[model samples]
Target: MPEGSLYRMAAADINAAVVFEKVSKSFGSHVVLNEVSLLIPKGAIMVMLGPSGTGKSVLLRCLVGLIKPDSGRILVFNEDLTRLDDQRSADRHKLFALRRRFGMLFQDGALFDDMSVGDNVAFPMRQHTKMSEPEIRARVAENLERVGLPGTERKMVSELSGGMRKRAAFARAIALRPDIVLCDEPSSGLDPVMSATLDDLILELHRTLGMTFIVISHDTAEARAIATHIGLLYQGKLQVFGEAHTVLQSSHAHVRQFFERNTQGPIKVL
Candidate 1:
């Protein structure tokens, strides 16, 4: 079956958490995403794999309403994100409401250096909700505990090691109990053991919270361990996407080349 047809069939399911319909984006003459269509089901751990400039990050940004696509529609929980314009007040409100359902863990942790760990986790709740100080404190503790950073609330961001900082960022990501969590290179900058630990943490969080996770990563081992669904983007197109096992076993040239780590295939080294 064609990729578009497969995606359309999957998108027809009512349990889809996100649907990208022929989404395309361009930067001047350079095309980024070329009519990428996909369906991420609710509660799925989807790992998106690609080379550095294959538009994986662009797709994530489009999903979160940060960067608008030049064409096509993105549906989150049946609501069309492409239709919501931030320039208009009513649409801006809708966009904000839509964004509240998502939690983003940016690359480099993106934590405030000056703030305490607890304050960093509580920041979203304080901004988006009217929770009391006591309530915020309790929730912060709970999230910290969930991410295995318990009792480090007063620690400054600079005090934490690389792994600890990632955990702290993860703690903040789930602070609001979002329905979808977006992780950009969750295993980056960590040693092998720490990367595996983070992958385990992602699984634990998904199992416990039942949130859909969309992860952008280059770690093939991480994908093999945690991904329920897998996508490979190359040269601005989705070369392959499906169940993790199926994609891993794919005979497609791009998929095989990527999984096998071959130096020669359809994917040219640029």
Candidate 2:
């Protein structure tokens, strides 16, 4: 089956792929995310950009329910995520059901080196579905081909190059064909060519399949190429959020300098 079919089967009914309302998270006295509020429209590629330690990844984790906010509300697919405390909750099953609607592509590939590429890609389906071995085999092949990594099924993850590994992980991420694909630095460690390729792939997926992509990347080149919208986070708050060109052309000193990559700006030099 084509990957688009899988995505259609997994797309959520909620109009917004993700909604954060006054969300705050802290590690003791250190506040990482403060009142971060945004609504990511369905099928849009929204890139969150900022310097290191600006909590971009933390917010991504929060979006995926990996980290709970200390306060405020997160509604994924219109379900109050905070209420998924346990199986006893009335909508717990439904909330968990939404889990399949999204997938994550980690910064480091995050693939198990011990497993072959095919096995790695098949991991989620194996864990979540009752599909037979042959069915999984076909699905993995289809996903690998979609990411331009056909016949990589038996290759060990360690054998792949940085770009290949990223692509492989991307293949795995989309194997389940999630409607919402949260990518944390998808092109972090790759060369310019590879990064561009990755960005192009994301754009293709977005346009062809209407996948909602939430990318957390400091790679300006990558972000500029693929993001339909942009959000800039600084000092535990969103400094700006809007359409790509508008936010990129903001008069805000911080936003300007950040995009320009100049030494002098509102970004305090430590």
Candidate 3:
């Protein structure tokens, strides 16, 4: 809470986990996002759904500063990230500190193939904390076990199956015990049974850790199973945003058509 700062501020009592205000982004001739705004409450799982190239992933990247928006503001816990100018020494430090609070699980898991499964999980703890090797090892084991991959520290990452790899990535994402976790397409490229299993793991983690989760996903069933809130993005704009049941049961033909994977809907086929 700075004295009289222009940083976008949420109410002290609102307890919003993340807020985006009139955010817009474009790449050359293509507009990826247009005045997108949404609120993610703490301890809630918000599933963002859209077709490919609809800018759901871009929206996540913007929050973590991977891609800067062309305009507008993004706030985490009332701290305006968009206002944190990296050219200033103090602001740069603040930006780094703010980012360290986020844990991200990439779409493909993005584990280092050369690193052992245990070492991969320990990577964040090693870089971010002064924890001893023994402590790091213990945390790695604990996280692996929690993801239902118990005692997998000695195994090579290349040896694990696709589902195992995703779960391992989830383990690494939580290694820092972050305030919020960002997951991009958690169920992508997995069989239906494995996807269901992964969805169960997501629900379990949310229940136990109570961390705010914003997940970008195409799987309607997975989103319905795990989301406390659901948002739909279409053509550089948000079409709908609401609680899971309300959004899922939407009378909007596009919403209903999307969930049903219908070819005849408002969403244009590329």
lDDT of 1 by residue, 132-211 (tens): 99999999998889888889999999899999999999999998899999999999999999999999999999999999
CA error at residue 88 for candidate 1, angstroms:
2.1
Candidate 1: clashing residue pairs, number: 0
Stretches > 4 Å off in candidate 1: 1-12
lDDT of 2 at 211: 91
Per residue, candidate 2 scores C-alpha lDDT tens digits across 151-174 of 999999999999999998998888
Q: Poorest 10 consecutive residues of model 2 by lDDT?
A: 1-10
**Candidate rank order under TM-score:** 1, 3, 2
Which residue pairs in candidate 1 have backbone atoms (N, alpha carbon, C) closer than 3 angstroms, thus clashing?
A: none
TM-score of the candidate numbered 1?
0.96
TM of each candidate vs. truth: 0.96, 0.92, 0.95
Candidate rank order under lDDT: 1, 3, 2
Clashes of each: 0, 0, 0
Off by over 4 Å in 2: 1-14, 87-91
Could you tell me which 10 consecutive residues in candidate 3 have the lowest summed lDDT?
1-10
Candidate 3 per-residue C-alpha lDDT over 46-132 given as tens digits, one digit per residue, 9 for 90 to 100: 999999999999999999988899998888888888988898999999988888889999988999999999999999999989999
In model 3, what are the clashing residue pairs, if there are any?
none
